[model samples]
Target: MKVSIDTDRCRGFGVCVSLCPEVFTLTDYGYSEVSVDEVPADLEGAVSEAIAACPEHAIETL
Candidate 1:
């Protein structure tokens, strides 16, 4: 699976970073960003959780 963050919809809550650090990180500007083009097998579940936990619904899978 692939993941991407819609920066326009982000509010820097850090839920994605806390739930899926392996694939997500907070930018210097405080928005969240995806660290990989494709989700690793081990991190897929965590990424999914992050997507759901995101209060702004900023994370999406492709």
Candidate 2:
């Protein structure tokens, strides 16, 4: 699976970070940032949950 975050739509809620710290982090500007554009096989479930929990709907999976 591939994941992408829309930085403009992100609110830095940290939900994704809490759910999947391995893949997400908080930027200095206070927005949620993806550590990588592509989701690794082992982290698919966590990443999917993060996508679902995103309040701003800034995460997309492909």
lDDT for 36 in candidate 2 is 82
- For each candidate, the alpha-carbon lDDT, in order, equals 0.90, 0.89
* Number of backbone-clashing residue pairs for each candidate, in the order shown: 0, 0
Cα displacement (Å) at residue 61, model 2: 1.6
Q: 1-62, model 2: which lDDT tens digit per residue?
A: 88778988998889999999989999898887778877889999999999999999999876
Q: Which 10-residue window in model 2 sums to the lowest lDDT?
A: 30-39
Candidate 1 residue 27 C-alpha distance from true site, Å: 0.7
For candidate 2, the lDDT comes to 0.89
- Candidate 1 off by > 4 Å: none
Q: List the residue pairs that clash in candidate 1.
A: none
